[model samples]
Target: MFKWIQGGISAVTGLAEPEYGESHFHSSTKRLTSKKVNPYTRAVVSAGDFDFQNPSNTNVETATFYINDLETGYCGFAQIIHSNIGITTTAQFTFKLYNNNKDLGFKQIWTSTKLENFEIVDKKNFKADNLTLQWNEDGSLRIKSEVNPESIVDLLFKPSITNGVKFGTDPNTYYGPSIEEQWGSMRHVYHPRCQVEGTVTNLTTGDVIEMTNEKTFGLYVMALQNMKPHHCAKEWRFAWFVNETESLVLMQFETPKSYGNSIVSQAIVTIDDDNETKVIACPCENDLKLLGQYKDEETGWSFAKSVDYTFNGYEIKDNNVDNEVITDDSKAITFELKGELSELIERMDVMNEIPQFVKNIVSGVTATKPFIYQYFSKDLTLSRSDVPESAFRGSAWIEVTYITDEREISE
Candidate 1:
């Protein structure tokens, strides 16, 4: 759940004009569907897409790396979470390691008086405490940290798809009563299909694993969410599904009912090429549907038992120059994962993750119940429309979130 409400209240208290509330949002999808933007066009990707934004403009920013596979049978993610609240700026380095069975991890937080602990050297670099993330001159990403004793970070993410992906030319969604009265902004950029090199020690077992790019893969994400949680979104759904040669990823969030409860999502599908420069990254005109959901007792939120993801868009027919970007609308790509989720990894209470001050302030005003359901699996069936029924050993990490109830989500 997004904390958009807090930001809205903050702006009001600070005497900012053009109040943000019901009927204020201008959704990106609304723009995309207005006939002005062609949904079937190729995604406009760029090397500059990874640039870091000014921290003062947003409350939270993160550079996260998700390890898709490891020859030693371990996989997980590392994230440097930077947050600005009131007059304090804090950075949290968190990592979780998982295998085919169990999981382990650690998170360490460091706060600075005026962002003295965090440093931004340039477009491709930033340091939050002992963690250093930078892009190399050779189109690779280096993430190193000396923040702890239990887990050490020294990893290189070599992009199989060199250019970062921005779903559309605009690159951001503006929300408010109008463009001039913008109350919030949402942006995301993805670095997918990377060959990860280097090693990170196990969080608990203390075992050292040798790392190489040949058998490993991961995704890097740069995200900015600049509003109070509830005022921004009611739910968020994310999925990263991959095999050796391809991947399917979706990033989505829904505005609260006050903002029309609009759903905005981005989907990407990529096919591998041994030559890094030749890989194909496709941005889909997509829709994701949740099926057969039931109410959970603990969170009182619905859990989706099945998912159907449809990717409709053009693709590079082949490497041949004459092949052209083509699509068969009648046979748009589709995939579904049904039945039991492979593994119920974790159930998170969003309130537990926020600062006590913010918690106290929010608890006093409105009804806010936020929970996240996370699932992970090393082996899950991902079947394309035309294939060997199930063609590959796919790995996935998915999250579904539910926040306060203003209006019930029908689906």
Candidate 2:
């Protein structure tokens, strides 16, 4: 009733036309009935199937560079976003540095944000304010930020040996009657495994935090969402873990109830083991199990003490291509995320943490409570059917959202 009223009002005033239909979402429309091991959502997500999509399109997009220092337990991230809200568009950039050790929290003070002069030059370069992030032909990025006098950054992210990945063949998860008439879309690109060699200096003490290839690892994610945040999904769970010899990452996607409450997920496990050193499996089949969940009395949102992920896919020991489905179990594989969820890094309240303009975009979602929980643990274990259980220091970023209760919509 409320959305119908809004649509009727919008129809007359040239307001935002919220897309209305379910046919546009076929990216995960149906799982193949003949997967070798498990029901698969994405068609063929092979290593090197990852390609950079233009965020400058009619969508809200963000590119993030996250770093983890194995030597000093320090982590940092730099993000540039192309924000397209109702009746407006803007570019935003933010940089944050975190430390597991509480004492050196002094250096964490140098944070920066900007709201203008952003440009996405191509798949390789982007600029927001005075910050510039450019990617080389070899998947290396040069990041330089001088937008803030408080912090100075000169960082370079080079992929030592990593595979770039995305979910499906078509890539964009659309929502509407068709592509030409679609009103919403979402996509993601990942280099879940990488290395960082750079320094972030704080002007207060002239102190420097150095990250190198031998002692630090980094993960890169580029994502896009063209609709109001709440219209996309009801909940999301994410995990990224890298140990001495392996890196496991998972992203669980859940569509909103209005869209039939669909679940489609993607995950990858890259190993440098003896038999295979490549991405063992970039699976489109994922199961996220929420464990030890308790309700937050203050917010009424259920928070989980821990979560688990199970993935099944074909092991691309270098033979799988990007176009067809694998039908043989000869190289089928499975991976599991079973361990402590580590330290609670931060509990992010979306409405309170975001800027005012960004808030206006999400304000339309009146019934949703959006919170993100980030955890970092050094003791969680990664279990694979082929190898011994191994523990690794890694980070998990989770989001628990409550949209409107299930409501039937008439076509």
Candidate 3:
């Protein structure tokens, strides 16, 4: 169930709850569900009895470096390059940083975090001139060096403090819209070390293929680094929401604060073939039209009472062969996605524990909250893809949008 905790911030916990419920991080169990909880809690999530991460109780904040280049090579058209690092509330925040420039043919990815007595460096400035990195038997990384805290970047503080901040779908906490807009950039830029690990279950083969990638990107995108929920409406965004035969990719981005607050650039990407990657830059301009929206008493969730959306289609292109992204020259097609606002709100429900007294003060009964999500990309489209011949995966895409909806319950 969706629960928004109501309370003031806890000085000791650095964690806060909404006004009428418990902190999501405290009640977290497993799986990224809509069940209100901390986005960075170290809780084990399970569906049925299958545990997701081993020792599910162990809490570890995940960070990563990502580079989304719509252009295949040299003359890159759109470059969304950045890094992000985050850690949950834990004992010691000690980690070894690694470089990943050659591993992925793109940028840097972290190597390992098995260093001892190593110095913490500033963001973008690493003193690898005298440090030695080693790998451990358990596959964890280790470092050996006479650490110079002052010389090495103190990414957790000062010049590089944003690197250590957590960014994810954390309900109950108002991280602001900027947090959601820059979710991708912050994860890959600020933090010097990061990894991308996941499992790809081939629906056709029924064999689960596992993959773990440790890579780092050097550049930083401010949009990704400084994001948090409740920051502003400028960060709320959307895309055309694309779908294809081999794959589907939806691209959506939040617009920085502006007079016309609306999702400017947002779309999903899908790929059936390995080399093929489709990018949709602006969805709202292509297929997003607001018919009406409203809130209800029972569910207390606001929904698009009516929405008119469109999709600029994709087809294989001839020139894309050398790049092997598509079989034929890319063909753009346009389609529509029109439906009622109720369709988006059918799943919302009121929180029974929320006191009526508090609800009166904060009136948002059907707010989408700060969920920086695009379910049509590799990581997302892959996981949520239910095609009989396809599986699912996840990937981070930059989202920049402008939100200007006065009908919001919270407003």
Candidate 4:
């Protein structure tokens, strides 16, 4: 059943714009086509290819994608949600990305649609019921369930900053006179590790499971600090991903106006004998391969395959990489990552017609090096198994070895 009014509204408005503040928020609506649909109450959904589900709402009857970006010197994130059982209900989606820097904290907000307002959907003209979610990872994640029939109304929300606008770490906010002046670079390269905690409620079974898992990855960035005339001088572009069930995370980033770009990779696994901690460092030099790409309809944020991952003890099949022995046999867990880096500097240069002083920072810099890294299983599996179930509460830490033209890549 659907209806569309003359001033008929749409389910999703458009991608929200990023604004300055302490935090940013974004949201959008989608509908499922299948009748025997998977209940949103049990399943959590997210925009972007990165599927990090909040532990709080596990099983959902109906769900929406919410994102929040908190601004500190670094950044923190939170995902908020709501669900429905029978009647037409509404929920708000929110998330934040922030930097914790005391002097230059920054944030932004982006919302695709608005709430407190109704949109129209006429059954007769409504063409598609199936909501197709796109991802850089090649896998069919369809709605598979055995329960009631459901549909989506108008999905809308707004993105606004929390604490107004603030300069990012720099106090004297303004750009210099020249567009081609050379600015300095800021480096804070490290491996990112995370521990997540939440509760998942099974719609059919009516059971709740608390989830707390840790994932680690590498990170790269080029940063800028303190400007006389120009307030925001630093620009950074990077990539990273987190795999919890398997303890892995990686990233590569460089700020605009840097001497040379940088890449890093790292991993942590359970040790064997006494089962302590073992780390694998990033390779001095490597190559990246781009396998796929996609974009979110609501936020318009895009992601591209930047590298290929391969593990020594693991296997890659149909473009899918996974633990070979752990899944089939009781063999050692080993892994490797391979991938490519897309040239984003040219595109970034045009961002808001960047001021000359800002442009000076990234002058003559070129991205040439590709990063390669590997991880092998020792007693990691055995050690994780030994941890009491009580210790799996989702609080985790990550470490990374950084290497570039300047430093050796080692743990």
Candidate 5:
């Protein structure tokens, strides 16, 4: 049977209205389905499907592309979000450009209409107005966006490991076991490691920043959430560490107490040596620990700067598992983050970025104070079981939804 946590503390509490329907917000158990290839990908074996449609008020889909160039100390992040809540829908695009001279340029453009312009031609292709995202037949991805006049990003993602990783209980299910499904459904897939190349052009300044493959690393993610954001998770932690020899991506989140205080964590580790690439997938959360948290003065949210985790690596077969564990103590996967809070790249009050109507809807439903903080770190060291110790010089991003903090709510 599909096991789910029983009620403890309701994340919704008095905020939820009866009109939203209790079936959409209650926890229930069901029989676990057998592992099979995702029906959405039965005809085409691309990176799953991008055409996720749900009429619920909390349905949301997003695509994010991030690149970090170690050689020139430049980084770029571009994302698009399509959120449909109740009778209204919103489409937003955002871009951030960090230059070699320590300059950060950011922009966000949105429209409540014109959502029809966003298209998913197939499981591997997507387009939004002037922005075009495509996964090539050879497994590379081309991402181009001109949604903002001030900043235009044209990038390419060439995976070191052509086959990306999928996180779910089985091929038929994409979200795995989490509180997201108990209340609603949230799922994610990622191309964890890639060689990135492209350019970020500033139209107003008529300047162009070239991103070459020399030392440019990237991570691509596609996510879907079918419930109100605040009701699904209370906090989130994400980071990517890339050096000359390896790339590591970590994602962890805490479900609201309504779901038994469960935590979901996943990691992808990629190593490149002598032109050979090895991708390790940690599909299960076993003995995972996130500790040592300090509150950020600016955001007023506690975040962990370190992590201790262990998982059984597996080689996926036929989009399912054969119950085989692929890692041992010597070659097992572990991650550690120790460093000074180097440079704060960006801190965003997410609610402020959305429309007031949507903000009211969120505030009316939950006491969520959502904030996102992005950082650049150069003082940390990363060590793994199979690779030599290396400096964890890269970027880290954190998102927190501070609930029930009167101070934050007042602010």
Candidate 6:
């Protein structure tokens, strides 16, 4: 349950901004003070080794790795979570391997333990019990996990983007604005793109699936939420689209009505080749227009089947200028995902993944529904008014979260 002040609800509803000591929201003239890191250094620190020992016990941090194989149509995801609230602390690791070609749609493995069991060996290495993630000196990642016998994974992540862009307001401070002082702080950093290799062995069936470097691309993300997850955002949508030469990553989330129903978003566009002139890392506002939606009869839940979205706003080029006009009305960028309802890959029911006690606690406090979806389509396309159409034939991951009275449970 959220710890709302006596009049916090009114403040959240646009009456006034919630107060929490000094304000961290920068004015239009004040720019971020953190120094920009080089591409190689970006990969290491972007792993998120920030301070979590907040005396308020509201800090939560997560590191996620997303892998996709274009040729084999296999997608893999691994997440490590560390949260400390008051006197209690929780640490967890989760893995999901999705293979559409296989008879079984996907496999999930998860475990929860104390925070002491997790170790961060510098910015390049992270260990949680039997699972070890090591970023090699050469920039490749060596991952080995023996947490679950049913699904054993050994893989390597080789970054494809040499000059990856770090998306945030300040590189030294939290990823974005300090919304926590008002409502809760939600921040993120993205490693635009990477390539994946190695293998995932199903110990149960004695089967070994080789994950090669052939047409395999990936993305890395680190996120921090400084309050209870339910109190932070009312909804979230994240998408990553990649091809051989270019990659586009977008993240958007909306605050609860109590927080004045505000929306925050960011985007990173990276193009790798000899012909490209400059990389575009912009902060943009996103609008989602739902073209189609599907409601599951059994779960009484609705999800977007197809949607058209656009990201339009100013771009931050340098410290001297905070908001620079990169794309005007005629130069808007838009993306469209067209696919049948039956084609949508239902990744998981996040509520069912957590421990029952925690689930009950959340359910008792607020209304929350979380679902993950993945889509691989040759029809997904991207077009910027300034450039030619770029046909993207790959996979995309989507997470839909609804909180409080905004819950979209159909039944």
lDDT by residue for model 2 (28-85), tens: 3243323333222232223333333543334567878887776687776787776765
| lDDT for predicted candidate 3 compared with the true structure | 0.26
In candidate 1, how many clashes are counted?
12
How many angstroms is residue 203 displaced in model 3 relative to the true structure, after the best TM-score fit?
25
| Best by the lDDT measure | 1
- Model 3 residue runs over 4 Å out of place are 1-231, 234-244, 251-258, 268-284, 289-294, 298-301, 304-308, 312-332, 337-411
In terms of lDDT, the poorest run of 10 residues in model 2 is 38-47
Tens-digit lDDT track of model 5 for 281-346: 443443444457788786567655554444434433232332233333223344554454455656
Give the per-residue Cα lDDT of candidate 6 at 51. 24
lDDT of 4 by residue, 89-164 (tens): 3333222222223355232221222133222122101111232222212221211111111112121111110111
Candidate 4: where is the Cα deviation over 4 Å? 1-183, 189-194, 198-245, 254-277, 282-284, 292-306, 309-335, 338-411
User: Candidate 3 — worst ten consecutive residues by lDDT sum?
Assistant: 72-81
Report the lDDT tens digits of candidate 3 across residue range 33-107.
233222221111111110111111212222222222211211000111121113322211222221112343432
Candidate 5: which stretches are off by over 4 Å? Answer: 1-57, 100-116, 168-183, 281-299, 302-323, 326-331, 355-365, 385-411
lDDT on C-alpha atoms for all candidate structures: 0.64, 0.63, 0.26, 0.22, 0.57, 0.55
Comparison by lDDT, 3 against 6, better one: 6
Question: lDDT for model 2, on a 0 to 1 scale?
Answer: 0.63
Q: What's each prediction's TM-score? A: 0.80, 0.82, 0.30, 0.26, 0.74, 0.75
User: Least accurate stretch of 10 residues (summed lDDT) in model 6?
Assistant: 32-41
Instruction: Order the candidates by lDDT, highest first.
Output: 1, 2, 5, 6, 3, 4
In the order shown, the candidates' Cα RMSDs to the true structure are 5.6, 4.6, 18.5, 22.9, 7.1, 6.4
Off by over 4 Å in 1: 1-23, 33-47, 55-58, 102-116, 202-205, 273-285, 304-306, 316-332, 335-339, 353-357, 386-393, 407-411
TM-score of 1: 0.80
Error of 5 at 333 (Å): 3.7
Per-residue lDDT over 303-322 for candidate 1, one digit per residue giving the tens place of the 0 to 100 score: 77666666554443442232
